[model samples]
Target: MKEKKEKWYKRLEMPDAFVIIFSIVLLAAVLSYLIPAGTFVREEVDGVTRVIPGSYTYVESNPANVLDLFVSIQKGMIDTANIIFLILIVGGIVKIIEYTGAIDAGINVLIQKTKGRYMVLITLVALTFGILASMGLVANAVIAFVPIGIALARNLKLDAIIGVSMIYLGYYAGMVAGIFDPVVLVFAQTIAELPLFSGMTLRVFIFIGMILSVIIFTNRYAKKVKNDPSKSILGNRPFNDDEGITNIEPPKFTVLHGINLLIFVGYLGFFIWGAFTRSWGINELVGVFLMMGFTVGFVSRISPNKFVKIFIEGARGITYGALVVGLARAVVIILENSQILDTIVNATLVPLQAMPTYIGGLMLFVFNLLFNFLVTSGTGQAAIVMPLMVPITDVIGITRQTGVLAFILGDGITNIVAPTSGVLMAVLAVGGVKWTDWLKFVWPILLSWIVIGTLALLYALVTGYGPY
Candidate 1:
């Protein structure tokens, strides 16, 4: 026992995303041997496929053999190929921007504009990110901009965590609020047959609460670091407070840099237009970002070969994150191939029918929280769980809108820690923050959010706040 305790694994080493995800895939394969296999019939709901209520059935065991387990990794990669490409493109674009020194020049201008009042800068940055993240289409797109937050933090003389938290938690808080999210909010409400964006007042309040919570939490940390640089967890490393650009003389805020930033803002407008009106998905986003890199590269006057070199370097840097996403998808594939995902869903949700209405609803939220580890995709979560949940809410004297609320709360909030989240892996990669460190920093606030989420769901249960 002593030797085991002393082992590095036992002492606790934070496994990187690849290890964590591959381990999950292995666990899913093992579960296939123990859990009964089942399937759910899916039907077209408003041109979208959805699981049919009351259509679950046990099937003959299809235990995932070794061959199937190995095959799943490749299949999983293929299934999420679009997301993988988008990740690579985002990495490339970020690198291209960096090569041009546009970020440093932009921050120089921002520093002059803000006049070192970091409270105003941090709050404004957090709110801007929160608003953008509230739009589901822009959420993943926001990952490419993580470096800017770090730059802003460095310029403000704060640590990396402070800058990242401003973007990560700020966006995440808005995401969990599910205010205008098409995937987790509208899609969930649609499955539950509630009006689009129903329960607006309560969610609006929750949204505000979330934004404020993130801002307050981030501000506190920023202050701690400001008061004593030694207080930052990241200070333990070969910490450089200069953010790598402090030595650049004269703080070059050239007109060319302004045009480059303007071009970026214009591209953001185009990108937002595409996401909203064109129903742009991963491929469209990849194309837009790739082109944006080229446009900005030329505007910043980087030579073609050098631009390509830096862009490739950036994309190469995030290969691990992209791979993590594909590997994480393997967990779903193994479970689906073995038919245990449906079985697990059935096993978890079927029991809610027997519990008291409020207790059942709360457990439903709990189940979604735990299940998010497996189905990390918000749209995928809504598809699999909503069919199970919407019908239960109807039969259990709970409002369907309440059911949607519980689901978004559970699925959305857990994204930060769930190793399966592609954005989580990607951000962790680019931000250079270990997953363990991120968890340590956020868990207190995360726990508070969980408490808030529970209360919100309980209120929904008590008030039956719904138009349905």
Candidate 2:
């Protein structure tokens, strides 16, 4: 009876990927419509501010109309298209390098060198790559390492999921820390009206700490997956593997490998120099990656025709990922237009304002967690939420930096389970793990991390870690 019940629960809980995604989109649409969102007018007389009656008006132009909705959808499509193009350009170059056997040879050498501590070596590689990814070379890093991760997993008898998770989580965790993160830096600095790299010291410290925690946690979880195949976290019944297997010859190591290696190393060195020196902007870094790809592709001896195909294929694969990004953008657009976002922020802040500082910080932390699902992009969320939060923090006597920290904490932690996160889906697809299965394996750990992160943020607030 217990076994049957467990089976039933597992079966029922399995998320149909399409259905899950569709439901989320539908929910967002419903919320956009049902939530009262419109422009509000506040009149200030003699330094006193009051909400004038009937001042809150639903602007007909601003409501979620057919044209606006269509435009939003179109915008989402365009965003996906741009991402796909970028992926193609980058993926193609990486694929050419792989074809030349450079990456595989490098991994083989590393594995041989690491010997018995391959797991630790792989973890470190993942962490290093994760940090690099946070610096905005994400696509290049992912394309470069995913195949290597798969190879390493096969050799170590570890689930490939571990490698995939390591890369995804590491990058994301670094993103959460937001130290010199282009996305975070631009948005936060703009909204907070602070200088770029203004809070560098503390942001770097948080970034390092978060990266370490991710490494530790992901390594432990992955080790469990490696050691035990029977532990069904999400009740993912093993599927028949007859259909998905593909057979391709592994590349033979040659002189091209050496040339490709030089190219890769040179590119990486330049990137590191650029990052540390702030010698280039994010766009410039992207240009560097493009140059690296072209150089490596040529070195790999990939024929022009084949190279073009590889680029196209890589780009095509990312179409869905880009679409997800666009949808995320649309959600943000709706939040912005609806005016409900302000209301939600004000409502949350009003009650918290009366509380003690620590308690208020805690409230912001909790609010961030809850809101993260709706606003998946950390930078975008900050843009929408921060302005309102900064004012609220001023009113509540909490520092703006505390508000930023809370936003970071909330935004970063939720990506682990957020259905809307493109990277989560990408990782699952790359690892061949089902969505439901991943959530089962990940949720408990992520939830615990959120609590820990929240505590950390509260500590930062109490200690006045930010510019008060």
Candidate 3:
């Protein structure tokens, strides 16, 4: 019955694709306006409660003014530029690696050894490298591995979508669960004013658990698709035999391959050492990636001029993603400047204040999920929400750490499907899957993960894991 229902739904003709995309965008815009601001009040010894003001004030007098719109647009453009520069630098290095076939060579060896159990291979590859990609080298991990995933799936008679989904699942799970992720860690710690690395042990456990769950779930899902072609998320179309599994003439492993391998190894080793030792920061990691790209390009006999061309190509691929990030940031800026963030929060949480502390934590978890769609960056969202939440958590008798944990879960889970998330779109494009198709496949998986994760958050509260 379930299978028949799914098949029936799949057969229903989708409306104009543009309508679906437009509706989603319009819904996001509507939600941005409708969601009330979050605010909290402080009490004095005189038994009077004061209403806390928000960061930005909503302009009722001149709502449709052109000057204000221009200023907002300008700020959005500047933010986009900043993000593009970062993407260009990172993408350039990864492109050089790709152009030289270093990543392909490494993946080929792994695929050859794995042979028949392709699903296990896909899961393992994603889980192992996903964590590595979280450390500021965003584009490298996805660009290098996603194509390999597609190729591998083709060979196994599996749909390319499964491989694409697993690969991204790994990257995103790692990005969100990262204990040392520069953006997330810095954002959370700075906002909470806690010591950097204070929550390392707990975070590490969560990261490992999530990674394991992803691998297990991905493997099971992929296997089901393999056994039942009709179940394949990308559709059970026959594999294209013309796309050869191996290069007709595999590139000979030369001294250049060895050199490239060493460069890759050393590049990752330096960051691992720095993270474990707490000796460096995100800037250092960025510097290392830039240096490694050039080193690998030169060692692989890529001429400087040609290497620059590859860099340009790679940077071009990320331009769309960069723009999405910028536009998403604009929405956040508008909410911040309008002081509407407080209004949204206060309206939502004030009624919840009478509830138990654990309930308040649950409320935050839900709020974070919705707000994250507009503010995709974990660190940025934390800065906006934590201050308001901390005082509220105190009043409601929840620990600050529990509040932060809720923020982490909320911020982490939404990135997987959030339309504003550049990484999500990048992964989808690389895998040749449409955004709607990807969403159709992963919605159930995401919902399941959220339910499990929420239970974990509740457990933390019950056990008094942090200061409540």
Ranking by lDDT: 1, 3, 2
Q: Which candidate comes out best when scored by TM-score?
A: 1
lDDT per residue, candidate 1, 106-141, as tens digits?
987778887877878889888987877776646666
| Candidate 3 local lDDT, residue 340 | 55
Candidate 1 lDDT at 337 equals 82
lDDT, candidates in the order shown: 0.79, 0.61, 0.63
lDDT of 3: 0.63
| TM-score on alpha carbons, each prediction | 0.91, 0.75, 0.71
Error of 2 at 305 (Å): 3.5
Q: 1-468 in candidate 3: lDDT tens per residue? A: 999999999999755323453344444345545654433453332342333334344344222133444465457657655444555556567667767866656655666778767767876777766676555444333533565566566556576667676677777667666666665665665556666545555666666766776777777777887787678665644222233233244455566766787797787677657755765544565577788988887677778899889888767665544444445445555655554556666566556567788888799889988878767766566656766777777778876677777888788788878766655655554455555667777776688668756877787778776631
lDDT of 2 by residue, 1-468 (tens): 999999988887455655576556555556667776655466554453434433345554344665665576566556444443444444455556656677766666666678847558656876776677556555323533454565555445455456556666667666666666766555655556566656556666666666676667667765675566455242232221113222233355567777788887788678656755675533454576678878876666667788778766655544444444455455556566655665555556557767877777788888988888766666556645666666667777766777777877787788877766655654444344556666766765586567667767766776776652
Q: Cα RMSD (Å) between model 2 and the true structure?
A: 6.1
Model 1 lDDT vs. the true structure? 0.79
Error of 3 at 421 (Å): 2.7
Clashing pairs in 1: none
